[model samples]
Target: MILCADIGGSFIDFAVVHPDGRTEHRRSVPTPLDNAPAFIGALVALCAPWPDMPLHIAIAGVECPDTGIIHAANIPCLQALPLAAHLHRETGRAVRIANDADCFALAEAHFGIAKGHRNVFGVILGTGIGGGFVLDGRIVPGLGGVTGEWGHAPVVIPPPVPLDQEAAETLVPLFRCGCGISGCLDTIAGARALERLHLWAGGTPQTSRAIFEAWQTGDRQAGRTLDIWLSYMGAGLAHVINVTGSTIVPVAGGLSNAHALVDALDEAVRARILTTTSGPLLRRAALGADAGLLGAACLGLDIRAQE
Candidate 1:
């Protein structure tokens, strides 16, 4: 058995992966914030169902790249901490750690829709927008893993929204955002963006799904905001698409659930393409919520086979 984990801002998912590629057991727990030690301690408890050493561990989490220093936004207590080293010492087994978004891309490129594609871009459109690239199964870890901060890419501010508002969006950005850009595509196109748009249009703030519901029903405010959000997101994505020319761009995350918005996003992406007849096709992730854990397993499995 191999212990695989995907640690995100909110929850930590664990799975016992067998040699045959089956998940024998799975567990989930709230992520520990503010105290790395406490978080690791809780992790130890979660591992009780699986033995140590005999079963190797693999991990992926959201963190700072250069040092593998975990940022506290999701796991607050883990900020500036060395997660890879600590896990290795605790498990007393070979451990591999990558960022959560990177893991998502790897899983998709290796076994999901992106399989066999030479250049693959995996994206997440949830709380924030993120991206990861894989070429022939090797992940490109630019700037030590911050390469996929695509949502922070700038777009021209249009009328109605003032320069100060746009500047503030780019200046402070959302608190605790990894990209550090205020008022970014992540802030405007993600689930939170949908809720805020609802309030801005005089609707009681509701869930992203609700906004999608309105858009589907031809609610004018919802339709306009949704279009704006997709255009911005697509604009940022176009820069990547034009540069990499990746045929397959898998978009995951919370907003991926918005079918109506996703349809509009597809149209928006099509409009921005510069020179590709192949054209990028947007697809939902096949791994679902288990992508993180399964991806982490692939890391450990690959390493164990090497040894």
Candidate 2:
């Protein structure tokens, strides 16, 4: 068994996971964002009941593979901390850590929608965009332990010359991204960015949920916003697929709940990619909230395999 925890900005979700992906003793506790000692203590307390099990964490941050230092934007206490080492010392148990996005991909590859696939890319389309690449049932390692950050780099291309005059009106502005880069897909691809795009497209302020609802009901403005959204998002994903040669993509996050939207995006991506497959490459993630814990379990299991 592995003691697994999914550490988010707001909560630390804990569970004991069996090798087959069954989770038990699940619970959650408030995350101590500013106090490092408190953060350590919370995890220690959670692990106390299972004395011998190794602890594995899936966090909303990056851990440098060379230095072991963690950079979590939301959890200030963990910034620059070698979390696994510190936790192992405090709790007297071996510990492993991975980015939540990577963990999500690992879980999907091993036990979720991409179960049979050898190469899988898992995407998160929430408040911000994130992704993880899994090759041969493991999360592919890279410099700074960040392999699948497909959203950060600039990807927006200039809108093609309109075939007709009316098409010119739909061209989106190249907005600056939070990463301090201009024209990144992140500038216009995330949930919040989608709202910004909607406003720029001449629609009144509305939540992403409302926009999807409107689009499904055939709202012209909403449809127009999503048409542009699908075009860019699909193009970005096509680049990822082409480069990775992934046979499957499992999508998670708030936007993916819109089944029709995911279907539309899948169609767009298939149209753009070079390979011709008979079936869709993108599938809705099956693991849901349990992905993190199960993924942490996979991490622990990998460690055990090495030992």
Candidate 3:
């Protein structure tokens, strides 16, 4: 069995996962963001009863493959820390870590919607955009452990032609991103970004869910906001699809719950991409919240296989 932990900014979901992918003894605990020792202590305490078992982690951050240093923006204490090594030393057991998005992708590829696909991209459209790429049933190793982070790149530049009235009226700004970049798709995509984009398009302040609901109900204001959203989101995804040659794109996170919205995105992406298949390219995530922990288990299983 592998001890798996899905560490997020706010909580840590812990479980014991069997080799066949069944999980047990699952628990959730509030994360200690400000204290590194507390973070390690939390993991140690969670897995203490199952001594000698390997621990695997899916974290909401990047771990540099070369240096083992973590870059977790949400959990400040983990920044620059060698989290896997620290945990292993503290718990006296082997430990492994991967970005949560990558873990989600790996889980999808192995056990979820992208099963049997050689190339897959699992995208998370939540508070902000994130993704992970899987090739040949394995997560691709990345420089600075930052593969499949397509959300941060600046893809939307203002068109040169005279803008339509809605476009002119919206005047979407090149909002700065947490990654220290401007004009990034992240600034305009995802949940909070969607709300921001909605307001920019002259709509009243509302949650992304409300906006999606309004759009579904044929509200003109929400419809216009979503139109702008689909345009940029679809174009960005099309570029990713073309470049990755991924046969399937499994989407997770809050936005993925909007089936119609995902369907609309699929339509937009299909219309823009070079591929001409009649089937839908984007699929809803099968694993949902369990994806991260499952992927962490999968990561441990993969490492054990290599040994």
Candidate 4:
């Protein structure tokens, strides 16, 4: 068994996972964000009963492959810390860590919608856009642990044509991202970003669900917001598909619940990509919340394999 933990800003989802990808004793605990000792202690307490098992973590952060230091914006205590090494020492067992998005991709490639695909890109369209790239059944840990971060780069720029006064007032061509970049797909591509786009398109501020519902019902403002979303996301994903040559994209998170929305995105992306295929390339993720723990389990299994 592997003690798997999905550490997020608000909660830590923990489980004991078998080699064959089954999970047991799954539970959730509040995350100690401000205190490093508390955070480590929480994990130690959770895994104490399973002393023989190694711990594997999927975190909402990046771990530098060379230095082992993690840069986590949400969990302040983990910043600049050698998370896996410290956890291994404190817990008295081997430990491995990976970005949560990468873990999502790994899970999808192994057991979910992207199963059997040599190259897969797992996308999370939740509060914000995040992604993971899996190649040849393994997670491709990229430079600075930011390889699948397709959201941060500046891809959406102001149009050359001058906007009408009303359009100019509502539209924001560039919005600063948490990563310090402006005009990124992150500004307009996720749940919160979709709400933002709805407002920008001159609609009342509404939740992503409401906007999506309105769009499906033929609301003009919501329709316009979705149009912009499709264009920007379609173009961005097309570039990623072209560059990575990923055979499949499995989408997860809150937005994936909107089947019609995802289908529209699939159509838009397929129209933009260079490849020609009859089937849909984007598929809904099957693993749901279990993906993190399952992927963390896979991480431990991979470590055992190498030894």
* TM-score of each model, paired residue for residue: 0.81, 0.94, 0.94, 0.94
State, as a TM-score between 0 and 1, how close model 4 is to the true structure. 0.94
Candidate 2 per-residue lDDT, tens place, 109-225, comes to 988999989999999999989999999888899887988999988776566654455765556777888878888999899999999999999999999999999999999999989
For 1-307, candidate 4 gives per-residue lDDT tens digits of 7889999999999999988888889889999999999998999999999887778999988999898998989899988789889988887788889999999999998888888999999888998999999998889978777779989998866767998888777555688887888898999998888888887778998999999999999998999999999999999999889988998999999999999998999999999999987888889999999898888888987888888
Give the per-residue lDDT of model 3 (tens digit) for 1-307: 8899999999999999987779999999999999998998899999999998888999999998888999998999988799888887777898889999999999999889999999899899999999999998889988878999889877755667988887765566778888888878898899999999999888999999999999999999999999989999899999999998999999999899999999999999999999897699899999989999999999988998899
C-alpha RMSD for every candidate:
4.4, 2.7, 2.2, 2.1
lDDT of each model, Cα atoms only? 0.68, 0.92, 0.91, 0.89
User: Which of candidates 2 and 4 is the stronger one according to lDDT?
Assistant: 2
User: Whole-model lDDT for model 3 versus the true structure?
Assistant: 0.91
Q: Where does candidate 1 stray beyond 4 Å?
A: 45-66, 156-179, 198-206, 278-280, 304-307
The candidate with the higher TM-score, 1 or 3, is 3
Q: What TM-score does candidate 2 reach?
A: 0.94
Off by over 4 Å in 3: 158-171
Best by lDDT: 2
